[model samples]
Target chain A: MAFKAGVITFPGSNCDRDMAVALEAVSGEKAIRIWHGDADLPDGLDFIALPGGFSYGDYLRSGAMAANSPIMRAVVAAADRGVPVLGVCNGFQVLTESGLLPGALMRNAGQTFVCRTVPLSVENASSLFTQSFAQGETVRVPVAHHDGNYFADEATLDTLEGEGRVAFRYAEPVNGSRRDIAGILSENGRVLGMMPHPERAIAPAAHPSLGGEDGKRLFESVIGSLVSA
Target chain B: MKVRILVRLKPGVLDPQGRAVHHSLEGMGFDGVDDVRIGRMIEMDVADDTTDEALNTMCEKLLANMVIEDFAIEKLDNEKAPA
Candidate 1:
């Protein structure tokens, strides 16, 4: 069968179309658009993506409200079953809020919303999302948010690093994430939550600042891994 | 019954928003302030017979993120909505 991918759109999510378009561009298949209120995901889905945006106007906290919505329960179950899940920006907040990932994204230590392409290193190139990347290679991706500073206790950070679960790390300081972490993977490396927007960088642009196609490799990696599996 | 839940960033977690406000206070010439931390207060009205477990569940499940936050539940003695 054609690659089965789903992109979920929480209310106020602006990156849903970009995510779907990127998925289709890389996978040669239309990504199923799933709504936040829907309780069930389409079955046999090989991949699921939660795109970035200010869901519920970022009420309570970034991704706090949407994490409790009905659709997330289904998403959680899917992740538990070993389906690869990718969350970006606010979606990263949602993943942490939903308990699918650890730690919390707090307000930026710079006390401002940072929006630009920043360099990130592939901390773990073996995960489903980063397999296309060479270990420790620098990649540029766009990040736009006020609450991307990642925070967790020291012990959890040690555990994540020791297990090689950190999928990406800031090559240069962008947000004040602990240990300069940019993205992380679940225990089994089936789930990834990152503050950077790979979907925004998949297509090459006239301006180098607009990002090249490094982000496409991530989706390509996901598609390639799933197809072979 | 009326309940109040106070959610705070757990100790040692950075609070940039609170720090910004502290800077503003300093800029305004307020002195001797050692630090500033911010917390959220959520008030709810529920059935009189609501159980403690249910209230705690609400906080644990949605009201607060346990990773970097802690919450305390307070039951109001009487009607204490704003005057």
Candidate 2:
């Protein structure tokens, strides 16, 4: 069976094409492009991808406006139905804003935009998203965002940690996120949200300035999980 | 009714922008600035019949992200506040 993935494109989404390309490269299937305005997603989607970008011009708050867009209602419903979803950067913000995930992405503690490849540890290898990586293995991926600092109350943070919902942790402090969290998975492990753009790092030659193909495994993991399921 | 919603980062949450501004103030020879925190104020015009429940729902749903921020809602009477 061919993998069916859909990539959502909000008005200010700049990385939709890259996400589509990455999906195609990994799954060998063309990604369906969905606009933010449409109220419904295509029937029977195996996976959904929300790419990083300054949706709605980062108005009100990063990803806040886009989270309330018409299409998000469908996205939220689809996620609840166990469709795997991946949110990157701004898309991660949307997941938090939409209540699909916990915690919020605040402005970087450095108070400046951070754009560089950083080392991340695979904290949980049990989830569909991180199964490709061995537990505690470190990988380098690029992160580019101003509001990528993850914040949650101490109790919630503790709960997430105890439940092993933390999917990735920064090997080094790239942003002042609580507990150095770089990525997280939903309770069911069907949804994954992270600030780093794995799609941008999938191709080894894609970013020679920041060399690595560590991101390819992320896409492959999702594809493999769907195929096996 | 004119409703004002003040959304602020919860206490104990790090406020980098606020800290940066505080540093700038200290650089300008200001003293006794114990700390600084930044928040947002959103004012809205709603019908007089708008119930407190509705306002609270709005805050919980959109005006504030409960994870990192807290919100306070204030309603001004028509006589003194702008519609």
Candidate 3:
């Protein structure tokens, strides 16, 4: 069975096309583009993606306005139903603002927009999102964002780490994220929120160094697992 | 009534912007500056009938991000206060 994936597009979303293309290339299935205003989602969606961009012009706060958009209600419901969801960059901020994720992404400690391919270590390989990676293995992906610094209280951080909900950790200080957290998974491991742009790195040419094809495995793993399920 | 909301980063959190500004101030030869921190002030004019609860609600909802920042609401000009 061909896997069906859905990509959500907000008004200011610039990476929606790239995300759709990456999903299509990896799964051989055309991605269903969903608008932010709609309340319903396409049926039989194996996965959902929230692409990175300055949604709602970063008004009030980054991702704060988009998190309250109409379509996000459906996205939240789908996530609660165990359908896999991936949120990248601004999408991660949206997830946090929507209360799907534990904490908020703050401005970088460097107070500068960071854009580069940084090394990330796989923290939990059991999640559907990070199953393609080996624990402690470093992978390269480009991260671009001003508010990517992840912040959570100490107790919440401890809980996330103890529950193996942490999906990825920065190999080095990339955005001043707490504990160098680069990616996080929902308690059920169905929802993933990360700052790096994996869709941008789907092609081998996206990152010349490290001869990286690591990002392709992420899409492949989800699609392959969905097909088998 | 005019309400002023001061939103500031929580203590212990790194403030690179504040640090940069501090460095610049020191370079300009300002003494006894001690330290510097950056914050934003949102001033709004609301009707006299607006209650404090309403103002707090606005601060909680959008005027501040409670995670890394703290916000204090000040009643700048009230009906009984100076014009």
Candidate 4:
């Protein structure tokens, strides 16, 4: 069976195309593009990707407006139904704002937009998104955002840590994120949110300086999981 | 009814923007600035019959992210005409 995936495109979403292309390149199936205004998602989707961008012009709050859009309601419903969801960059903000994930992405402690590839340590390689990587293995991925500092109460943070939900942590302080968390997974590990743009790092030809193939394992992991399931 | 909602980051959460503002104040020779924190205020007009529960729901749902911020709601009385 062909792997089915959907990538949501909110207004001002610049990385939606890249996400779609990356999905197609990995899964050998064209990804369905869904709009923010759509109230329903296509049937039988194996995965959903929320691409990075300044959705709704970052109004009110980063990803706050987009989280309440019609498609997000469907996305939330689909997530609850056990479909794997991947949120990158601004999409990570949306997942937090939508309450699918814990914590909030505050302005970077440096109070500036950071755009570059950074080293990330795979903290939980057992999760669906990081299954291809070995625990504690370092990979370089591109991150571009102003509000990627993750904040949650100490209790919640402790809970997340205890549950082994932290999927990735930065090797160096890149965005003032709590405990240098670069990515996290939901309780059931079906949803993953990260500030790094794995889609941007999937093709070596696109980012030769970054030696851009390390991120392909993430997409491959999701595809592999879906195929096996 | 006039409703004012104040949203603020919880204590212990890092406030980089607030820290920058504090540094600017210090650069301007302002002293005794123990600390600084930034927050947002939202004002809205609603029907007089709106219940407190409704206002709380709004804050919990969208106006405030319970994870890192707290919200306080204040109801302001309308001005009365002089007799």
- For model 1, residues B1-83, the per-residue Cα lDDT tens digits are 77889999998888888898999999999999999999999999889999999999999988898888899999887856533
**How close to the true structure is residue A190 of candidate 3, measured as C-alpha lDDT?**
90
- The lDDT leader among the candidates is 2
Tens-digit lDDT track of model 3 for B1-83: 88788999899877777888898999999988878888888888899899999998887766777777899988874664445
Compose the digit string of candidate 4's lDDT tens values, residues A115-229: 9899999999998888999999999999999999988877888988999999999999998998999898999999999999999878776436664878889999999988887
Question: Candidate 3 versus the native: TM-score?
Answer: 0.90
lDDT of model 2 at position A219 = 94
**Tens-digit lDDT track of model 3 for A144-172:** 89999999989889999999999989999
> Cα deviation of A60 in candidate 3 (Å)?
3.4
What TM-score, to 2 decimals, does candidate 2 have?
Answer: 0.95
Candidate order by lDDT, decreasing, is: 2, 1, 4, 3
Candidate 1, residues A16-69, lDDT tens digits: the string is: 999999999998999999999999999899999999999999989999999999
Per-candidate count of clashing residue pairs (backbone under 3 Å)? 0, 0, 0, 0
Winner on TM-score (1 vs 2): 1
Would you list the C-alpha lDDT of every candidate in the order shown? 0.92, 0.93, 0.87, 0.91
Model 3 DockQ, alpha carbons vs. true complex: 0.53
Proportion of native contacts found in each model? 0.94, 0.82, 0.53, 0.76
How would you class the docking of model 1?
Answer: high
**Predicted structure with the largest TM-score when compared to the true one:** 1
Please report, as a residue range, the 10-residue window in candidate 1 chain A with the lowest summed lDDT. Answer: A203-212
lDDT of 4 by residue, B1-83 (tens): 88888999888878899999999999999999989999999988889999999999999888888888889998887763111
What is the descending TM-score order? Answer: 1, 2, 4, 3
Model 4's DockQ score: 0.74
TM-scores, all models, native as reference: 0.97, 0.95, 0.90, 0.95
Predicted candidate 2 versus true structure: per-residue lDDT over A1-229, tens digit per residue: 8899999999999999999999999899999999999999999899999999999899878998899899999999999999999999999999999999999999999998999999999999989998899999999999999999999888989999999999999999988999999999999999999999999888666546775778989998999989888
